[model samples]
Target chain A: MSRQAFSWGRLPAPEQRLIKLASRFDALPTTTESLLPYGLGRSYGDSCLNSGGVLVGTRGLDRYIAFDRDSGVIEVEAGVSLGEIIELTLPQGWFPAALPGTRFVTVGGAIANDVHGKNHHRAGSFGHHLLGFELLRSDGQALHCSPTANAELFAATIGGLGLTGLIRRASLQLQRVPGPWISGSSERFGSLAEFFALSAEAETASAYTVAWIDSSATGANTGRGIFIRGNHAEGPNSTATPKGIRLPITPPQSLINPLTLAAFNALYYWRPAAVARDALWHWQPFFHPLDAVQEWNRIYGPRGFYQYQCVVPMQDAETVIGEMLQRIAESRLGSFLVVLKTFGSMAARGMMSFPRPGATLAIDFPNRGAPTLALLDALDALTMAADGAVYPAKDARMSPTAFRQYFPQWQAFARHVDPRFSSSFWRRVTETEVT
Target chain B: MRRILIMGATSAIAEATAREFAALGDALFLVGRNPDRLTAIADDLRLRGAAQAETWVMDARELNAYPALLDEATQRLGGLDTALIAHGTLTDQIAAQASSEMMLAEFQTNALSHMVLCTELGNRFEAQGHGCIAVISSVAGDRGRQSNYVYGSAKAAVTAFTSGLRQRLHPKGVHVLTIKPGFVDTPMTAAFKKGPLWATPATVAKAIVKAVQRGKPVLYTPWFWWPIMQIIKNVPEAIFRKLKL
Candidate 1:
C-alpha cells in the first residue's frame, strides 16, 4: 500500500504488511523488526512515513479511558484525534491546552511533534499538558512513563517522533475555558517593528496571539500583515457550522505562480475583515482557519508543497527574519500563507521539543522543483547562522549536518529510541540504516 | 433528543455516527466486544453532549447473548428511537478460498451475528412502532467479485435480509436503512492502497445518518457509489470472471 504525508509529497509505495490489531495493550505484537506507529497520516513531512518498514495503523485503538470533569483531566488512546477530543470536551468547558493548526492530527502525532498552537505564548507546546502515557515495546512490555515515573523515557518520547515505542494511551491536563467562542481582535501592522510592538502588547492581554505576514512584501512595506489576538469568550457558543468547501482535484502547477500569490497576498492583506479591529470568533475559525477548506493543500497542485518553519533566539529574531524575508522577496517565490509568532518563557517538557522562548516563522512554498529546494536551503543557512532550529514535523529535506546542528541532543536522545522502531525522518536525519 | 442504541459501537463508522448523535444531545446505549473500548467511547459521548451515555460489553458472535443485550440497551436508554449496526470483518480472500473454516468464520461474524441482532432489535422496534434501524452493508455485496467473494457474500446476505426487513417494517412506521459504502478508508481497509475512490468514515457516517432520517430503504454512501456499483453490478460474468479485480 502507498502511504503519503498530508502534503502529498514522498508517496512511498511500501510493501503492504499487516500488524494485527491489539484490542488490549497486552496483545501488542512482539517483534524485533523496525515498526512505525501510524495514525491519521496528518503529518506534512516524512516523520510519519516508514519506507521499508511496517506501519501499525493506530486509528482502530481510539478510545477514551477516563476523564475527570472537575479537574479537567482526560485519558485517551493515542489514535484519538484532536477533533474528537474537542467534540468530547468542548461542551464540558475544557479544551486541549495546546493545539495544532488542524484538529485532524492524532494525539500521538501531537505528542510526537510536540505541536504548538496560537497559544504558545501562554500554554507552551503539547508536551506541557501531557500527564502520562503507556508505551508498549516490542518485547511486550508496557511501560508507564510520566514526569516522575521513568522521566527520562517520558522526555525522550514526547518529541521522539514515534521512535521510542507505541504510545497506547495518554493522560493529559486540559485547560478549562468559558466556552468555545473566542473574543478576539485583528489589527493591521505596517512593518516588522509594529508587529513586534503589537505582539508584545498581545502577550499580556490575549491568551492566544499570532500574526500572518505577507512574505511577498519588501522594503518599507516588509512584514505588512494582520495580527490576531484572542481569549476564550464567556458566553454560549454560536451554533453556526461553517460549510466546508473542497478542492476537487489538483490544479495545474502554473495555477499558483508568483503572480497569483502576489495578488492573493495583496488582496488578503487589504481585506475588510483583516482591517477590522474587533469581532467574536468561533474556536474552529480562530484556531484552524484552513480546515474550513477540505484538501486545501491540493491548490498547490500534485507536486504538493513544503512548509519551512524555523525558530531563532529572541535577540536575533528581527534581523534574521528580515534577511530571510528579503531573500524571499528578491527570489519572487514568496508563499501565500506566512505566519510569525513568539514563544513564551514557559519551558517545553520534551527533550527535542521545537518550542522555546524565541520567535518562529512558518511559510508554505509550492513544490516548484529545484528553485523551491534551493530557496529553502538558503533559509536553512540563515536560520542556522542565527542559532535557530527548523521544525522536524514540517521538514522533508534537512541535511544530516543541519539536523545535527539544529538538535545537538540527537545523539543522547538516540539511546532512548527503541531499537525495534524507526521512521524515514529518523533515518534521513541520522543517515543510519534500519536495523 | 433521541434515545439511541449502537451495537458494535467501537467500530470506526459506528463511533463517528455516535458522535453525530451525541452532538445532538441524544441518550446513547453503546454495546461492544471490548469493555475498555466501550467505556471509553461512552465517556467521550457523555462529554460530547449525550444526555446519557451508557455501555455494555458482549461479543457479537455470541448469538445467544443478542436478546439480553438488546434488553439491556432498551432498559438503559429508556427507549430506543434509533439503532445502528456497523461491525464486520474484512477476511483474507486468499485464505478464505483455501480454508472452509476461514470462510465459515467470516460468515459467522459478518452475516449470522448481524442477522441475530437485527432480528432481536426488529421485534422490539416493531412493538414500539416508531424508530429507525440502520445497518451497514457494502458495495461489494452489489455483485460478488473473485477478489473478496467470501466477505461480499456475507454482505449480500445482509443486503437481502435488510431489504425484507425494510418491507416488513415500513407499514408499521419503523424504518430500516441499508448503508452501502464503497472503499472507505478505515482501519479495516487500511492495508489496501487508497485512491480517489476512497472516502472517509465520517463521510459515510453522515450519509447513513441522513438516510435514516429520510427513511431511505437503501443508500450508497458518498452518493457516487450508487452509479459506480451499478456499472460493476452490470458487468457480464464472462468478463468479470477473467478480470483480476
Candidate 2:
C-alpha cells in the first residue's frame, strides 16, 4: 500500500511493511524489528512514516473496552477513531473532551500529536482529557501510564509521536454535551487587531472559537477575515448528516494557483450572508467541515500541498503573525485556508505538546518546489525569533536546528523514545540513525 | 430493525457492513475467530445504534463448529433475518502449488468451510421460510490466473456452490446472494498495488447491504466489475493461456 500523508506533500516514500495487530492482548507481543504504530494516516507530516522500518498497523485493534454512562468515561483500543467515538457516544449525551480539525484521526494519533482544536482556549489539547493508557513496550512490558502512574513516561508519550512505544488502549474523560448541534456565530473582522479582540471575548463566552484570515491580503488589509465562535446547543436539532462529496481524481497543477485562491478567498470573506451570521450547525459541519468533502486535499492538484502551523507567545503574536502574513503575501504563494486562534493559559500536560498560551496560525501552500521551501523557511525563522515553535504534526521539512530550538527538551524526550522505534520526522529532525 | 448475523465479523469488508447495519439500528450477532475483535465489533455496533450487538468466537475453518455457532447466533439474535458469510483467505499460489497441504488448507477455509456453514444456515432459513444468505465470492474466481490460481480455484468452488444453494433456497423463500467483488482495498489485498479499478471496503459494504435488502441473487460490487469480469471470463483460453494477468 502506498501510504501518503494527509497534506499529500512529497517526501521520501517509506517502505510499506505493516503487521496487523490483533484485537486480543494475548495475541500481541509479535516481535518485529524497529516497529512504529501506524494509525489512520491523517497527520499532515511524516511523523507517522517510518521509512524502511516496520509499522504495526493498529486499525485492526479497534475495540471498545468499557464505558461508564453515568460518569461519561470510556475506554477503547488505540485504533478507534474520534468519528467512531462521536457516532457511538453523541446520542448518549457525551462527546470527546477535545477534537482536532478532523475526526478521522485515531485515539493513538490524537495522543501522539496532542492535537488541539477550536476549543483549545477552553478545554486544552487531546492529552488533557486522557485519564490513562496502556503502553506496550518493545521489550514486552506493558506499563499503565497516567498522571499518578508512570507520570514521566505518560508525559513523554503524550506528544512523543509514537516513538515511546505502542499505545494499546486508553481511558478518556468524555465531555457531556447537551446535544450534537452547535449554536454558531460568525463575525467579519477588519484586521488582525479586530480578530484578537473578538477571540478574547469569545474565549469566555463560547466553548469554541477560531478565525479564518485571508492570507492574500497585504498592507492594511492583512489579517482581515472572519471570526467564528460556537457553543453546544440544547435539545434536539435536525440531524442533518453531512453528505460526502469526493474529488474523483487529482486535477492538473493549474487548479489551485494564486488567481483561483485569491478569488475564492475574497468571495469567502465578503459573502453577504457570512458578514455577521448566527446559525445552528450540526457538529459535523461545525467541527469537521473539510470532512464533508472527501479527499478535498486533491483539489490542491497532483503535486499536493504543505500545511505550516506555528505558535508564538501572546506577547509577540502580533508582530510575528503580521510579519509572517506580509512575507506570504509578498511571495504570491498564498494559502487557500489560513486559520488563526488563541490558546488559553492552561499549562500543557504533554512534554512535547504544541499547544501553549499563545496565538497559533496555520496556512496551506501548494508545493511550488524550491520557492515554496524558501518561503516556509523564512516563516520558520520568524517563528523562531518570536520564541515559538512549529507543530511537528504539520511539518515535513523543518531543519534540525529549528527543531532543537523549538523543542528544547528534545534530548530528554529522545531518551524515552523506544530504541527500536523511529519515524521519518524523528530521523529528519534528530539527524540520527535508528541503530 | 433487521436482525443480522455476520460471520468473520473482523474481516474488513464484514466490519464495514456491520457498521452500516448498526447505523440502521439492526440487531446483530457477530461471529469471528478472534474473541477480542468480535467483542470490539459488537461494542462498536452497539454504540453505532444497533438494537443489540452480541458476539461469538469460533474458528470458521473448523467446520464442526458451524452447527453450534449458528444455533447460538439465531438464539441470540432472536432468529436471523439476514446472515453474511465473509470468511476466506488469499493464499500464495506459488507456495500452494509446491505444497498440497497449503492448497488443501486454502480450499477448506475458502470453499469447503463456507459450504458447510451455508448448508447449516440454509436448512434453518428454508425451514423458517424467510431469510437471506449472502456470501462474499471474488472476481478472481471468474477465471483462473497462473499467479493466484489456488485462491481463485477456491473462490470458483464457492461461486458454484452458492449458485446451487441459491437455486435450492429460492422455492423455500430463502434468498441467497453471491457477492463477486472486484479487487477491494482490504487487508487481504493490501500487499497488491492499487489502481482505479480498486474499491474500498465501505464501497463493497454498501453494495452488500443494498443487495441483501433487495434479495439480489448475484452482485458484483462497484457494479463496474460486472462488465470487467464479463470481458475477462469471455476471453478465449487459447490466447488467454499465452498472456499473464
Candidate 3:
C-alpha cells in the first residue's frame, strides 16, 4: 500500500511505501527501502517524510498497555494520539504533562519531536515527562530506553526525528489536574518590549502563557498583539470535548494574502474575551483552537506552506523580534498565525529537543518557491548571528550547517541512528553521509 | 442495561465497538487469543465506565472449547444481551491456492469457527428467548472474484448461514445480524491499499453497534455498501466471470 505520503503542511509529499504495522508485537513489514516510523504525520515538515523509502504507518498499533488511575502513570502503544489519552484519563483527573497546540499528534510523534506546549514555561518538553519506552530496532532488538538505562539512546530517540529506531510503546508520567476547565485571561501589548514584560509577570502567576503577534504589523505597530495566559480552574468544572468542523476542500490558490491577513489579525486581536478579566474556558479552546478546522492547512492551496520557528536568547529577544518583524513586513508576505512564547530555563532531557531558555517566535508563510526560501534563509542568518536556533520539527529547508549548529550533539547522535532508518530531513541535513 | 460478549475482542473493529458499549456503562466480557491484549482491553473498558469488564483467553478456532467458553462468560457476567463474533483473517489468496492446508485452516478460522459459535450462542439465546447475535461477514461474500475467492467463499458461507439463522431465530424472539463490511481498514486488510471505498474500523464498529441496538437482521455497513453490493450481486455471470474484480 505505497502512496505519496504528505506531511501536515502538505509540503514535500514524497512517494513512500506505506507499510502499516497493526500490532507492536508483529514483525516489521519487510521492505528493501529504508524505514521510518510514522505516527499521525503531525510533523509539519519533511522530518516525517521518507522519499524513496518506506513509511511504516504505526497508527494501526493504537492500543493501551497499562494505566494506573491512582498513580497517574499510563503506558500506551506509540500510535495512540494525545487526544485519546486525555479522553481516557481526564475523567480520572489526569492529563499529559505537556501537549502541543494540536491534540491530533501521536504520543510517538510528541516524543520524537519533543513537542512543547503553552505550559512549556512550567512543564518543560514532552520528553521530560516520559518514564520509558520500547525502542524496536530493524534487527528485532527491543531496547528499553529511559534516563537510568540506555540513557544515550533515550536522548537520541527523543527529538531524534525517528532516526534511532521505531518507538513501539512508551509510558508517560501524567500530571494530575483539578478538572478539565481553565481560568484564562487576555490583554493587548503595544510593542515587543511590552510583550516580554507581560510574559515575565505571568511567569509565576499563570501555568500556561502564549501570545499572538500580528505578523503584518510594521514600524509603529511592530509586535503589537494579544497576550493570553491560563491556569487550571480550581472552582468551575466542565469536561466537554469540542466538536470540529472540517475544511472540506483545497482551494485553487492561497486564501491568505496581505489584505486577508490584516483583516483577520484586527478581528482576531479584538476577538471575544479580548478583555475577559476572568474567564472559565474549556480545555480544548484554551489549548487547541485551530484544530476546530480539521484540515485548515488546505487554505494554503496546492503549493503547501512552511512554519518557521526560531528561538533567540532572552537578553536580545526584543531587538531580534523587532528586526525579524520589520524584515517580514518589508516582504509583505506573512500570515496572521504568528506565535510568540518564552521557554523556561531548564536543561533539555533529549540531546536535540528544541526548547531551551529563550523567547521563541513562530511564523507561517505559503510556499512561493525561491522568494520564500530566500526570506527564510535571511531570517536563519539573523537567528544564528544572535546565537539562536531554528526548530527542526517545523522546518523543511533549513541549511544543513544550521542544523548542526542548533544541535551541537548531532555528530554524537548520528552514532546511534538505526542504520535501517532514515528520513528526507536526515538526508537533506546530513547530505546522506551517516558515517 | 446490557451484558455484551465480544469474540475476537482484540480486533480493531471489535475493540472500537466494545468501547461504545463500555461508554454506555454496559458490562462486557471479552474473549481473545492474546491474553495480554485481552487484559489490557478489559482494563481499558473498565476505565471507560463499563460496569463490569472481564476477559477470557481462548483461540477462536478452538472449537472443542466453544460451549465451555460461552458458559463461563455468561456465568461471569450473569447474562448476555448481545454476542458479537468479529474474529477472522485475510489469508493471502495466492498462498492459499498453493497450500490446501492453508486454505482449509483459513476456512476453519474465518467461517467454520463462526458457525459453531453462532450455533452454540443461538441455542442459549433461543432458550433465553431474547438475545442478539451479530457476526461480521464481508461484501466480498456477495460474489466471489478471482482475486480473493477463497476468503470470499468462506465469508459467503458465514453470510448464508447467518441469513438462515436470522429467519430461524426470528420466531424464537432472538435477533441474528449479519454484518457485511466493505474494505474496512483493519489489520486483516492492512496489506491492501486504501482508497475512497475504505472505511475505518471505528466507522464500521459504529454501524454494528447501532444495528444491534435497533435489532436489525442484516446490515451493509456505511449504508452505501448496500447499493454497491447490490450492483455487484446482479452483475450477470456472463460478464462477471470474464472481468477481474
True contacts kept of each: 0.43, 0.48, 0.33
Q: What is the DockQ of each candidate?
A: 0.37, 0.42, 0.49
Model 3 reaches an interface RMSD of: 2.4
Across residues A1-435, which tens digit of lDDT does each residue of candidate 2 receive?
A: 456542245443566566666553633435555678888877777887877777778887677778888999999899989998887788889999899999888899999999999999999999999999999887778999999999999999999999999898999999999988889788799888898888888788899998899988888998899888899988455555778888787787637777887898899999886755667888888898899887777777767778899999999898889999999988988777799999988988999998988999999888888999999999999999999999999888889889999999999999999878888889898984323
What CA RMSD would candidate 1 show?
A: 3.9
**Residue A30 of model 1: what lDDT?**
54
TM-score winner between candidates 1 and 3: 3
User: Considering chain A alone, what is the TM-score of candidate 1?
Assistant: 0.95
lDDT of each: 0.84, 0.86, 0.89
For model 3, residues B1-245, the per-residue Cα lDDT tens digits are 78988999999889999988988898999999998778777876887778998999888888889999888988999988799999988879999989999999999999999999999999999999999999999898999998998999999999999999999999999999999988888777766777899898889888998999999988998889999988988999999989978
TM-score of 3: 0.95
The candidate, 1 or 2, that scores higher on DockQ is: 2
**lDDT score of model 2?**
0.86
For model 2, the stretches where C-alpha displacement exceeds 4 angstroms are A1-33, A254-264, A432-435, B1-3, B99-102
Clashes of each: 0, 0, 0
lDDT of 3 at A96: 91
Query: Which regions of candidate 3 fall more than 4 Å away from where they truly are?
Result: A1-5, A235-237, A270-273, A432-435, B94-103
**DockQ of model 2 vs. true complex:** 0.42
* Total clashes in model 1, counting residue pairs 3 or more apart in sequence or in different chains: 0
lDDT string, candidate 1, A117-221, tens digits = 999998899999999999987777899999999999999999889989988889999999988888889989998889888999889989999999998898998
